[model samples]
Target: MMHPSESCNHRKSLFNTMNRFIGAVNNMDQTVMVPSLLRDVPLDDVGDVKTVTDDTASNGSACFQQDADMYSSYVLLKSIRSVMEWGVLQGDGRGKERVGESEDDDLEKQFHFHLNGLHAVLSKLTRKANTLTNRYKEEIGCGNL
Candidate 1:
């Protein structure tokens, strides 16, 4: 019962929605997504999640998490390097003198690194979710809703 123009528009909209979804999925980051994605399941079950989600790669947070992790890792590395370099500049020590450097330094570094990574990963996931949700909204059509 729909007009030809209306039908064509509907098809175009559907195609756009699908293309956008695939693009979003293909562009996700994986490294950062692994941990949190594993959170809800048993350690042994992680493999299952991976297997199940593998086909629908965009259905989970892997890609976004990875991108986030990379960005966070880069930032954390930069920050640590900066703090170390700056501390050296400010102090009268030589050969990468320890500032905030201790037995727990490595642990602290990792903790902050992961935390920052998590934050970034979550942010990216959120953005992707928002985008996909918007696409769904658009596909459903405002007038229909």
Candidate 2:
């Protein structure tokens, strides 16, 4: 049977970016059977995803309701994937940004650029999902799953 990644010849199927993202999100959902287990657990790289650091506080509190907890991280990752799925359904927001998108621009070039961006972001999200799953296991004191 053919894999779903080959459904669309994405960049000549050199990078199955969408399939990877969907797989990552699905795996995360399956591994994280109990969402409550991830509550209050701090992420490893808090600095990389501090969305909006509090400027009013002297102690420099972080965003996502003060701390970047595992539960929040899970929610954020899922939300992003959801948004991307929705974007696919509604078509890409190319004209909405309007940075340098002229009619003369090479469509293939733009497709490759966005495909590369998706690959990078999806790879990071996949890593974070796997890390969070491992952390959850550790939190529960289980060595192997």
Candidate 3:
């Protein structure tokens, strides 16, 4: 059992760590945009303003959907990583000796399992993006510009 001051300090530390994690997640959300390849679709002149045809609009929507899916998956992976990191940090504290050694081992195993799964998903997303980019290049008869 923790003394009153020790419990208070522990809570404070946890709060600070949570704040940092939330800030990191928010920063990632703000900075990560859809790949430029997805956003480089050309627009056609329609009256004074540029516009996309129905087919082009549909394609653009599909690209946006793919981008959203990738981004969400990436965010999920990051969140998991952040939580695992926080767990490691906490384990480094007095809690490590208090918490059974087996618990730490189990946590480490879970972290690795989730990390590997997320990496696989991220790899597939990268491959899909690359395939789309190559197809676009072939259709346009020009390399990525």
Counting clashing residue pairs in each candidate, in order, gives: 5, 0, 0
Leading candidate by lDDT:
2
Q: Arrange candidates by lDDT, highest first: which order?
A: 2, 3, 1
* Deviation of model 3 at 78, angstroms: 15
* Candidate models: Cα lDDT each: 0.39, 0.66, 0.43
**For model 3, how does the per-residue alpha-carbon lDDT over 1-145 read when each residue is reduced to its tens digit?**
7899988666445344444445444444444444343344432211222232444245322222322433333334354445545653332232334444565567988877866665554444333334344444544465544
- The digit string of per-residue lDDT tens for model 2 on 37-57 reads 888788876656535443312
> Stretches of candidate 2 above 4 Å error?
1-15, 50-67, 86-101
Over 4 Å off in model 1, which ranges? Answer: 1-105, 143-145
Q: Which prediction has more favorable lDDT, 1 or 2?
A: 2
Report the Cα lDDT for residue 20, model 1: 42
* TM-scores, all models, native as reference: 0.29, 0.63, 0.29
